[model samples]
Target: MPDLGETYACVPSTERGRGILISGDPKSDTILYTNGRSVLMLDLNNPLNVSVYGEHAYPATVARYSPNGEWIASADASGTVRIWGARNDHVLKKEFKVLSGRIDDLQWSPDGMRIVASGDGKGKSFVRAFMWDSGTNVGEFDGHSRRVLSCAFKPTRPFRIVTCGEDFLVNFYEGPPFKFKLSHRDHSNFVNCVRFSPDGSKFISVSSDKKGIVYDGKTGEKIGELSSDDGHKGSIYAVSWSPDSKQVLTVSADKSAKVWEIENSNGKLKKTLTCPGSGGLDDMLVGCLWQNDHLVTVSLGGTISIFSASDLDKAPLQLSGHMKNVTSLVVLKSNPRFILSSSYDGLIVKWIQGIGYGGKLQRKENSQIKCLAAVEEEIVTSGFDNKIWRVSLHGDQCGDANSVDVGSQPKDLSLAILSPELALVTTDSGIVMLHGTKVVSTINVGFAVTASAIAPDGSEAIIGGQDGKLHVYSVQGDSLVEELVLEKHQGAISVIRYSPDFSMFATGDVNREAIVWDRVSREVKLKNMLYHTARINCLAWSPSSTMVATGSLDTCVIIYEIDKPASSRITIKGAHLGGVYGLAFTDDSTVVSSGEDACIRVWRLTPQ
Candidate 1:
């Protein structure tokens, strides 16, 4: 409701394990990648024009652009394959349950009418081919006893399919109801990737044996092999061919991606791509793709590095963000450029709007962060680890950080900047008052805490509890003494936020009900203001203090105007791929939010 569209997008795809899909061709500058539950299409020429098709029921594992470029064939973890129109209309052409397990890889034929998919399916650990528009079986895949890891289609006709699997074998197939043509026992370890060159004259495969083999695309004869001695220090994971079918890009577990110039130039070491101190073994470069002028590689740390032919050794654009469920985000009024967000994976990152990723702030808790608040030079966060952490923005300039253990798991945090020494922590045990890493006092609410907010004056504190009740307490310097209880909600309270001007406060409950109450008297101002149909997850107030925005499980964000209460509501349904979990207001009213979709979107409100 606040905005018609998103201004800028924070691109961060979840690196679930090793299956990172980057599919595209040289002619078309756009490359498709899986981000959260949606398939992202980003134009190499115009990165800002990222299109997200997010109707997948399960997390997407593989996405392939049809040869015709008019259709998209995608497979998910649920073993379901969906062929949909590529025009963003979400027109479903066909759906097929190709396997009973995760689909590891899928590719469309050169003709673009049929697709072959394979993975760790039930006992049917074989590749299967079917027509794109109608779920008609086109062929069968066999010879691999273990899970099929990757598959590729020969681009220039004669219709050939190559598949590699955990059985350490590569099988070539041919025909309409495809039959096995030849089985090559080339790798000593599990084969990880199988890819065909653009010319269809040869193909390549890499395996966990730390080797990569090139083969004749038509005859299935091994042509060459990239040895472990000089190829890669660690096992190879993926292989992608250049558009001209002259160069091959291979990513490995050794934290490097290499390009081998073949054909006209003979076998030569073209270049080496490495991020010296990016990380340890955990930051293995797992996926690589070549798109015309640039090459994109993914790191195990979920970092995307784009390299150009002009500068092969140095990656030009390295995009970094978050990769798990974003739990909390805070944007400070003073440092408008810095945006801080914490995730369920115990990750905390500081983002600069104009730049990419700024830096990282460490957290003591090892669990999901519930709430975060910024104070002058310090940032305080509470988490499911039952602890309150004091994080310094810049440790050298700010004070050192400290952690206070709460008896019960903390769920939310509320800080009154006016009383810098006081921190209000909501836990399943009760509402605790902490004075600089020490518990001043606690008031047991007898219910689990969901959300909390402190008055601008720091004199009163309101906590939303699991029992759908509001527990109001009078703040006495460092402790909170229970004052009263408001029990109008029928469901657990999800969010509570005080207006910027302290004139009113809003509480959103799980029942999709959001109520605005008078801050001074704690009396309901807007009762039964219901626009959402699902559980409310987050709520934020506009900088001007006249409007309130709420995000819910319904995948919608609704903004309510205070002055024009009755009819001043704007609704942006399906605002996020999944339900919205965290929302923060930017300086210029750009509502930044993160959700199950694993993407952080900045919606630019169309001025009303």
Candidate 2:
């Protein structure tokens, strides 16, 4: 059986013209962000090390750590707030239904006793303050005419709460049973973010009009504005104060993050860190955080840019990966270090274990890649654009080369074991065999082929159909000759895989059933390995062919041993926040899995 080991979490999801939130722990160097119902915590020292907390049922929007660093309060799109432990297993403490719409931001009081959440609501108020344990109302939010975008709390004595909104206003509140004190209309456009300095003596607000204002923390009195000569050229989305309260950082849509020095009740630009990109929409900087000596920002493409607080002249170190659901994964046999993965939006990223993303493969068009097949020197891929591309691999680098258009959409791709260059592609109309870069033969099977696999000897192949039938064929001169038809599955076959040693094969269907068949007898060798409750998304055989693993849409991963097929099985529930999509065995004792959560996880197999 296998146990979960390390997880490589994706970057925070971002949107245009909106503020993205990232919170840092008060006691440690970890920062938190939300993506697809999961809150990810990444260590500042080692960006590859990550932790995922996935108890939220709806899409998570914002999360914040308590002042004591003992608890975390996270909210979702359904306006549900959940408080959980910060250590051990991260157990849930309480759950509350706060509003009717999306929660944009949340903050904890200086004493870690109460929490305030603000966002878009229906007929009810968009802001609410309640006790941490009992969910009792502690304060009211009453000054915004539209959606509240951000919120903050005073860090010193005489508690105060501040909120900014699309109404172009910043509201101030005071007390335990807090009441609205005043509303400051300083910006001519929507206010995106508000934050109080660490010393609780000053606060700052940034808006879409390319303006930032400093105010008196206690009396809500207007102080001074940031220097406009060197200010942001586009809308500012987020602001963060340094730990010492002498400096602040702001990220804007102009693809830059600037550091400002606060002196004499005014702010002046100290340095500017411009993100390097192609000037596309993905280059927009949406969120930022300054904790300890590290400054982190996230772009709309989900890349995390990290900068040093003492020096902003050098280029920032970037962390990049897939931002959407992963659909296909392939591990090269020649070198196991290079891993290639494709997402739903046709983006492909190559990753090296422990070192992070290496580079990306350029797609010819906007079409999802269905499957990938690897050889010794090149990799083959089939896409929804009805074309096959060959990517040449040299040492650790790979790039796209020649491509040929198939007649129909390709569903699956497989390569011959003896002759790796011989590839077979299953399509809606038939099967197409390609030798090198040209289509050698095309066979119209007259059925919708869903999946296919080739034998290691390059002598036989099996094609699965949507009608729950398997057609066996013999390879003869780049053509498939039909032999027999087998009917055991009740639903469409989604995946078919053969063991590395080629002793047996496995088939999984949409009805959540998997069967292992003996190659010689062509009969069911194991049928009781059916514990998944939803569609089986992927399956993998260990390198030694001792065990098989299956990933499902039910958010579970199950491992079945070949010797004790019926009794010895390990079920890992909630393996991913969303459904699992791809699985690949790195070695006999290790496997890598990816899913709709946009994260890649590695598991270690141990003998039980």
* TM-score, every prediction: 0.93, 0.95
Residue lDDT tens for model 2, 498-583: 88888899999998988888887888888877799999989988878888889999988888878785557877777776888888
Clashing pairs in 2: none
User: Alpha carbon lDDT of residue 297, candidate 1?
Assistant: 82
lDDT of 1 by residue, 1-608 (tens): 45434322344353433545578745667777775677777667655566778878898887888877888887888999988888858688888898899888999888888788989877865678888777788876768888898998888878788999888999999876788889999789888899988889988888888788889888888888764445887778888888888888888888888888875423466777885443665478878788777888877766767888656756467665666667677787777666777777766777666553655564444456767788667888777778888867663233466888888887778887677667778776778888889998887777788888877668888988888999888877666779989989989998888888888989999999999989777788876578888999898887887778888889888877776673568787787766888888775456777776656666777667
lDDT of each: 0.77, 0.86
RMSD per model, one decimal: 2.6, 2.0
lDDT of 1: 0.77
How many backbone clashes are present in model 2?
A: 0
Q: Which ten residues in a row have the lowest lDDT in candidate 1?
A: 3-12
Candidate 2: worst 10 consecutive residues by lDDT? 358-367
